[model samples]
Target: MTYCVGLLLDVGLVLLSDTRTNAGLDNIATYRKMYTFEEPGERVIAIMTAGSLSVTQTTLSRLQDAIDIPDGPSIMTVDTMLEVAEMVGAMLSDVSGKIAGRMGEQASAARASMILAGQRRGGEPRLFLIYPEGNFIEATSDTPFLQIGEHKYGKPILDRVVTPETTLEDAKKAVLLSMDSTLRSNLSVGMPLDLCVIPSGEQRISERVRIDAEDETFQAMSVAWSNALRRGFQEIEI
Candidate 1:
């Protein structure tokens, strides 16, 4: 299990994903669930995955293979952000279906999900949450964010504060605090996070940050959020 989120803003997009996968209590492992494809100055695509590692890995591997092939309809080669979302959804659905077919009774638990976000030159930025069945929903002004995996704990803050008009700086804080909330509540979502910011129409990543467990700035922010929440709870009458 893992936690991954993406935010769509007037400025661009912000994406974050934790790197933790576990088969059992004794079999935890770390693997990056975020992948990016770009032709700098032309287009950039980012993806965050959750659920069955096999399904997600195979889907991503196939996408990369397509990107490497000349004239293939990969994310980088897609005509629009909508096309990128469709291509990824189709690949994800196909991979999970085939793998689950071979797994027999465990098919139900072999499902996976992804958050696809990015932009192409001359196009507006876009974000999507794709299910194991290849279906996807886009982020809209009414819902400016998308999350996958262990998302419940982090959703409250976003619901209250995020808007299509949210400033990029505030959006960053909202997402990190959202992730912090999840990390505190879910052991399945562990550390070493990957975060990326892509400003609208830049056609390139503006910032890519990695926050490890020991990162002082993030630690400070987490502690601050916890304290603030505690204070608010204590001040409110039940």
Candidate 2:
């Protein structure tokens, strides 16, 4: 399994995902779950995936193939973020159906999911959680976020602290804490996290980071969060 989360704030969007894919105790391996497409100042899109490696990889590969076609509706040619999302969902659905049909039930159960987020030159930044079936739902002001795979453990922090008005910096912290929660609870989701930030109206990724096991900033943040949680528990009435 994998864990991928994205936050849609007033400022922009923030996304994070883990690389671990666990088949069994001895079959663990690492694979990238984040993919990006950008035209610099015109548009920028990021996709963070989870679930079955086969389905996700095939779907992504096919999407790339379509983009390579001369007249296809690739991410670069889309006029708006919503259109880009619709195109992705349609492509994912088509690829997943073929893979599932070929693999039959058990193998197809490993179907993947993805979180798509970004902006086009003339539109607002948007975020969507794409399901294994290829349908998707956007993040709205009321929810302000979306997540997939091993998401249960990390949802609490987001529920308590995240909102549409949260600053992009704070939004990033919320997602990191959310991922930290999942890491502690799910053995299948392991280290070396990928993070991406897209500031509103920039039409480009503002920040992206890969946090390894010994990354100092992530280590410090994790420790501080642990201590803070302990203190919060201590201060609460029994």
Candidate 3:
């Protein structure tokens, strides 16, 4: 399993995903879960996935193949972020159908889910949670975030700190702490995280990072957050 989270704030969007993928206890490995597509001033899109590697890899490959075909309705051709999401949902559902037919019902239900986020020229930024069925729902003012994979351990902080009014910088910190929470509680989701940030209206990814185990800044932030949590707990009267 893995953990991937996305924050949709008033100013921009922040996304983070772990690199770990595990087939069995001794078969653990790392692979990036974040994928980005950009045409600079024209559009920018990012996808973060969690679940069966076969399903996600195949789904992404099919989407890429469509994009490469002449006059294809790739994400780049969509007029709005909503349209982009619909195109992705349709492709994901199509690919998932093919894979499910081969694997049978129960196994296919374990496939995967994707978090899609980004913006296009003249359009507002959007965030979506693409379910295994290839249908999706957008993040709204009431719930400005979406998460997949080992999410139970990390959801508390997001519930407390994230909102439509949160700043992009704070959004980044929130996601990091959320990931930290998951890292502390789950063994399957391991290090070297991928993070992406897209500022509203930019039509480009403004920030992207790969945080390895030895990354000093992330280490320090994690340590500080732990300390803060401890202090907060200590202050609570039992």
Candidate 4:
């Protein structure tokens, strides 16, 4: 299992993902769940995945292969963000179907999903949650965020605090707190984490970072959040 989240704020896009993959309590490893494709001033794309590693990895590999082909219909070449979502959805579904077919009765274990966020030159940024069936739903003003994999543990803070108008700085805190919540409650979603920020109108990724388990800033933030939560809980009259 894993946890990945993306936010589409007026400023741009903010994405976060954990790097843990576990087959059992005794078998665990780390693998990055965030992938990016950028063409500097022309376009920028970020993909975050959660589910069966085989399915997600294969789908990403195929997407990269498509991009490598000269003048091919890849995420970078797609005319619109919608087309990119469609392309990713199709590739993910195709890869998942093939893998699941071979797995037979265990097909459900082979399912995976992705969150696609990007922008092209002269176009507005977009966010999508692509499911296992080649279909997706885009983020809208009413709900300016999308999350996958162990999402329930971290969704409350987003629901209460995030908005399309959120600043890039605050958005980063919101997502990190969201991940911190998930990490505390779920062992399957361990870190170090990957974080990316694409500023509005830049047509490029402005900030990309990795937050390791021992990062001091993240640790301090986590501690502060815990203390605040306890104080809030104590102040409430039940």
Best by lDDT: 4
Candidate 3 residue-wise lDDT, 1-238, digit = tens: 8999998888988999999998888999999899999889889899999888888888888778878888978888868888888888887777777777887656655568999999888888899999888889999889999999999999999999999889888999999999998998999999999999999888899999999999999999999998998999999997
**lDDT digits (tens) for residues 1-238 of candidate 2:** 8999999988999999999997767899999999998878998999998877887888888888878999877877978878888888887777777777887667567577889999888788999988878789999999998999888999999999999999988988999999998899989998999999999989888888899989899889999999999999999997
For each candidate in turn, the TM-score is: 0.97, 0.96, 0.95, 0.98
TM-score of candidate 1 to 2 decimals:
0.97
lDDT by residue (tens digit), candidate 4, 27-136: 99999999999999899999999999999999999999999999988999989999999999999999999999999899999999999999999999999999999899
Model 4 spans > 4 angstroms off: none
RMSD of each: 1.2, 1.3, 1.4, 0.8
Ten residues in sequence with the least summed lDDT for candidate 3: 102-111
Ranking by lDDT: 4, 1, 3, 2
How far is 237's C-alpha from truth in model 4 (Å)? 3.1
Question: Candidate 2 versus the native: TM-score?
Answer: 0.96
lDDT per model vs. reference: 0.92, 0.88, 0.89, 0.96
Total backbone collisions for each predicted model: 0, 0, 0, 0
Provide the global lDDT of candidate 4 against the true structure. Answer: 0.96
